[model samples]
Target chain A: MVEFNKISGNVWNIPKSGKMLVPATIYASERLMDTIKQDKTLEQARNVACLKGIQKSAYVMPDAHQGYGFPIGGVAAFDPDEGIISPGGVGYDINCSVRLLKTNLSVEEFMKKRHDLIEALFVNVPSGVGRGGKTRVDRNVIMEVLSKGAQWAVEEGFGRKDDYLRTEENGKMSADPHAVSDRAISRGLPQLGSLGAGNHFLEIQKIDQIYDEKIAKAFGLQDKDNVTVMIHCGSRGLGHQVASDYIKEMEDKYGFKDLPDRELINAPINSDLGQRYYRAMGAGANFAFANKQMITHWVREVFEKIYGSVEIDVVYDVCHNIAKMEKHKIDGKLKQVCVHRKGATRSFGPGREEIPDVYRSVGQPVIIPGSMGTASFVLVGTKTAEEITFGSTAHGAGRVSSRSAALQNISGEHVKNELAKKGIEIKATSWKSIAEEAPEVYKDIDEVVRVSHEVGIGNLVVRVVPLSVMKG
Target chain B: MFCYAPINYINLMPQTENMAEKYKFLQHTADAKFQAFGKTLGEAFANAALAMFAVMFDPADVKPKIEREIKTEGKDEKALLYNWLEELLYLLDTEGFLLSRVKKITIKGKVLEAVVAGDLVANGYKTHGDVKAVTYNEMDIKKEKDKVIAQVVVDI
Candidate 1:
């Protein structure tokens, strides 16, 4: 019933109206239209279009849904010349992402060790609300962590340096720790290595189906039977407090008079307010990278202890929602712009200087994880992705229902028993968690992955089926 | 999915009228009930203290009433609320104390001022997740034309 200015099949535009300087463009499938019909994400899209100096169209991916300001599945690029950066756009879990680690161990091998492996992981990695990690770092060391990210974790005996080479932005962007406030450091003190509650999980999966054998072999995913661990987490309380700290400042200190949602608080890109927020946000990003890296070390240790030895290796770690400076061809001229991807993964195609050398021919490996009971995917970047979506693709199966609604409709205990019936062992702190993350509450991931393929954003590699799951 | 342990009990703090004197024992939903009213935010915070204590036993039952002072400051009103609630929770967690009364309170802008008086005691135990932070998603700051009506979504 609402009017949205049309752009093209790959894009739908929201025209500049009432303080808007740019149009909004949403990239979605025909099926995703209904979800947008029921929410204000479209209006929010238009609102983002209104922000000053928006370099390109304010964009939303297929998984777009209502969030604090810009939709969770949203993206917007701002002019380094004249634009604004908002913490709400990046969300509280700054640099929250998924990292895939492939092991020589296969599905059949995991089946033999499933019960013990799942149980050991559950005990080793602390899960649930207000949980503290088994490791701790002092305030000074944490500051270094804010600046160095996974490199710090590796130097601290967490993982190998090569793990950084395969990660986005080398696991740490240019973060200046002095910009971070002590409060952020304090809030993050206890959350290091903790598997915080909600949406965050560590799933052990096997490569079930290989769609592209040559590309799969090139990316260290050679075996269709090899197992890989996918860790999904974020900056924890540190990032939450960082975003919380900035939102209040943006609301009270810097006021954008006519933005649609007050939650979409922002500041001019070059201003001190903007600079401080970005650096602190980067610190949070570092915290998240370090967190996953530290956990990676423990994961390896646990495997070694149980299996006597592990021939495991890091695959790739990429952020789902983040903002980074990149050079892309616009009007056949290369221009450097800041790309803000909210709940979207970068699918940089071939020959991009930023991508690793091994992936130069096959494009970057994109890991798409479904729920514990559903099938996950491994996809490769494509040239079509670079031309159409700024080299981005859908992150995962977007939520189809609210948490409360899910609780009312499904029983956690029942879902657990059902998954067990499927031979997937579930280890969690509480059944409430199992209910909250029921696979049914999310969009059909297979459909989502299918759309991405049809759209030519990315091509499917292999399907990874779960043998066991662990959640916070 | 966000989940909470449903509240299944009848308990409220006693109240009196005349602004400072008027307070009520109220349950907002399946998870939370508090003595939420005030001549000001500080008074309302004080009542919240009483409500926390009442969750365990009759507020009237705690004998030899003792007193303590708690102060917390945050970047904004919402953060202020979190720290304020957390301070009270720390007392309950560390000191095993439940507050029963408030002698005085004041709220000037974001600065919440209150003097909470109570005793160190135990009440009926219920398995509860320590409240982490308050959320702003469904936060309510009701105002009837000009009068301010207080309500908020405290993330537990």
Candidate 2:
């Protein structure tokens, strides 16, 4: 069993041992730590600590939960010279991300046509299992989408040029489409704008509370009156294929002998396979960026069809699952490192060159979408985050119960009815899904956000509650 | 009336009923996990495919209206299982086909070929979930004296 030392309030350390390059640190309150200890999440975090070239410590957020190889809310940075890139660190959904759009319509105005709006959204956004989106493209177009990302969508008339600015990496990453396998491309071709199954969704929300008026105003968020839309999705099939292909390649070429787990199979950052996987993963991430852009366009059209050409500007788009080469202070010197954040969000602090200019003084917007019928928050990055957690924050209200266990305790019909009674409209492909994603199945969003705020990893700006939900 | 009573009544049960279950689904906090059991390696592989599809929809709801053959090669037994299941996912995502049954499977060294039957998604056919891909995480194929079992966790 792993032992912990309470170094400080809300902070614990798993001392470096047995092939560990660094220690493991967890940021959680005593109460939350009790719940976190119930799972193998900390064990996974300890496993990450053993990885080569890991700098500082393996960091786990307060909302951390068990995942395949890495905990859901895990962060670790590796030296570019000697470290390795594990696909599991990025998860299957390459850039599984969330985007928020502020609309001109107020809650009262939107409620007047809520039914019509929900219907239009449900019809426009192809959702659920095995469902394809409206856009169908051939291989050539698929390559373009992978290469140009959201820019391709804008040029193709799917969104505005300014939309990219609000997105991480401006909705485009340096990608090599040729490095991606044809099978991956083929799998993603028909599902361009789809909101895929299992935890993916599109929801309409209204601001319920504002903690920091300055930051909230900077994000263009208003109190109680303004309505917003959030889209939670990812790279879909293409990303999954990239991760699978690379993991297999690493096993075949590098061999998996002595590795703690096959799921952590990785290649040296500078190796040919590693570089190839990075490029391909980036391409898959681009596909996701383009996919969300297309969905945004459809959303705009629906709002326009109902409200007549209303303004809908993207507040921010942040990826929860990904790895990127970044420059950070390590051992009192700035060095390049590959920061892997699986089920974690990048919370770059104030004055970072990467953040959009408007919010540079404050920080990048870190969005955390809650489970269906729960409250989501908008937070800003902190300098402390960059120093402690590799500039990362919690991704979502991490799951506390298994899907099957949830099925036993919650009834889909009942959960749907309860949300409906609370004035939140839900449209799902199947009732079974409602049960699996019941709000109670997740950790408390308020507590998770409180820890994040108190730790200074991310500071809360606005909290929004669901007005309507579109589940896949 | 029935004078031909079997020496062992339990042994006289139908072979299908006497056999171990094809597969059983396990619970992962975020994703689904399963273990497939069979008396032979091929059966274990075939059952693993069923478990993957079962996570998406009830197998009873699907019919063998369409048939397709698949062939894959891996460096080892673990890779072989990974390749086989991934091929099934490829079909689901590319052709919108759901697996009803594995008609046949043949494994030679690291290569595998199989015949799968399913139906085209249409008005009568629908899927209840989407499985993104088969993962190497906690993936293992074990062979015992009387049976073989394959364990896998899929990213949904």
Candidate 3:
């Protein structure tokens, strides 16, 4: 059992006890804390704090829940020179990210063609289990994708060139495809534009609320006057294979007898194997960026086919799971650190050079997607997060129930009918997925967003409600 | 739902015939978990593969139309189980096969060889979930006088 001390409003601290290098902090309210304390989230946070070169306290977001090695909302930063890189820090689906697009069409205009549009999207976006992509690339082309990311998609006419500017890292990472194994490449080649199953979706949403007028305007969001499209997917089979390959390598080279868990397998940051895994991870992340870009192209085409040519610009895209090298202040000195956000997102504040020029003064745009059939939010990063949590923020409403329990508690038909009654059109490959990912299985997203905003890690700009959802 | 009798030479041993009843699912927060049992390690390993695929779709719905041979060696029994399931997952992801049954399996030291049977999910058979990767978290393969049990948690 872990003991917590209330440090401030919406913030609690687990004291640095045992082998911890630093205390673990929990950003949650009393009500949310009850649920947070029920799981091993606190224990995982403590375990993360004990890692080598860990700086500051490990963070547990309000949406924290139990995961294999690290909690879903776990966030930690390690010194690049001395720290270790673990596959658990990045998760299996490397760069499982979200991209939000703003359209000129309003809810009233989209409602007329909602069903047809959803059907088109469901058919166009290859989804479900073991499904291949709509656009198949050869080995040579897939290598380019693994290295170039979204830039490859734009070059292939999948999306516009400017779309990369709105994406994180310009939708490109310094990926070395050669670091990836041939098996991973084989899995990725046939799945370039496909959406894998479980919590991945494509949804059409309408602006429901705008919290800050200026930020919302800068994001091109107008409450009740504009609609948007959100794509949630990842690197598909390729990323999973890369992670699996690396974990085995780490286990084979360095035994895990002393480690707390085998899943927390790692190598020194400067080691050859560590460098190789990082490059492979980058390649996997690139695949995800290109995957989302291709889907964006399909989304644009569907809109064009239904409602002529209209404005559809990308607001911003953020990765939910990744470990990237960044410069942050530690002990009053700027240090290069590898920030591992397993189920968290990078929320860089204003003045960060990585952000685009259009939003440079306002900070990076962070998209926090709620559960299926629930409200999603658009927020901006804050400097406070950089000071407290390594410029990281909560990813989403983390799951609260086991998949088995969820299936037993809710019926797919009931969830479908209930959403339909609320006027939300859902097109899914299987009703079993609907039952497994029912909104009830997730934590309260609104409250999760509230804690995030109240703590100043991420501040809200606009909220959107789903009008149609297409799931794999 | 699918059964493959051993060759006439091994018909004298009946313990492996009904060991399919040994596996059952376990509840995990975000992933799928299962525990498989057997009188011998080979049967336990076979049941573990079945439990892994059972979470993705109903094995009864899959026809044993395709047969594939899998061989992998690990440093130990635990590593062997991890590699074995990973090999099966590779077949499912790369070949689009859904596991229906295991025809035969032999565990010699750290080496595992098995003949798995299933139909192609690409043949229009439906699946309920996707098993992303098999994990070593809480993985256990234990041997006792009467039974051998293997437990695994797979990322979905």
TM-score of 2: 0.96
What is candidate 1's local distance difference test score? 0.70
Off by over 4 Å in 2: B1-20
Please tell me which predicted candidate would have the highest lDDT against the true structure.
2
- lDDT (tens digit, per residue) of candidate 3 on A1-472: 8888998889999999989999999998888888888877888888888888888888988888877777889898887878889888888899999999999987888888888888888888888887879786899999999999999999999989779999999999888999998988878877889888788999999888889999888877865677899999999889989998999899989998877878888888889998999999999999999999999999999998888887899999999889999999898999899889988988889999999998989989989999999999988999998898889888998887778887778988999999999889887888888888899988998998899999999999989999999988
The residue ranges of model 3 lying beyond 4 angstroms of the native Cα positions read: B1-20
Error of 1 at A22 (Å): 2.3
Candidate 1's C-alpha runs over 4 A off are A5-11, B1-106, B113-140, B145-156
Model 3, B94-129: lDDT tens per residue? 778788887788888777788878898889987766
lDDT of each: 0.70, 0.87, 0.86
Q: Taking the tens digit of each residue's C-alpha lDDT, what string does model 2 give over A1-472? A: 7888998888899998888889999998887788788888888999999888889999999889888778889999998989999998899899999999999888888999988998999899988776778888999999999999999999999989889889999999999999999999988987898888888999999999999999999899955798999999999888998999888888878887877778888889899999999999899999999989999999999999987868999999999889999988988898899999999999999999999998999999999999999999999999999998989889999888777677779888999999989999998877877888899889898888899999999999999999999888
Colliding pairs, model 2: none
lDDT of 1 by residue, A1-472 (tens): 3467445554566776767777777766667766764676787777777776676677777767766567767777777668888887787678888899999876776788778988898888865554557776788888889999999999989989888888887888788887776767776776777766567889888778888888888888878777889888888777777776787688678763555665678888788888888888888898889888888888998888777678777788888868777776666777776677777888888898878887877799887878658888888888887776667787887777655455567887898999989878888766766776788877778877887787778789888887788887
Determine the TM-score of chain B of model 2.
0.86
Q: How would you order the candidates by DockQ, starting with the best?
A: 3, 2, 1
| TM values, all candidates | 0.83, 0.96, 0.96
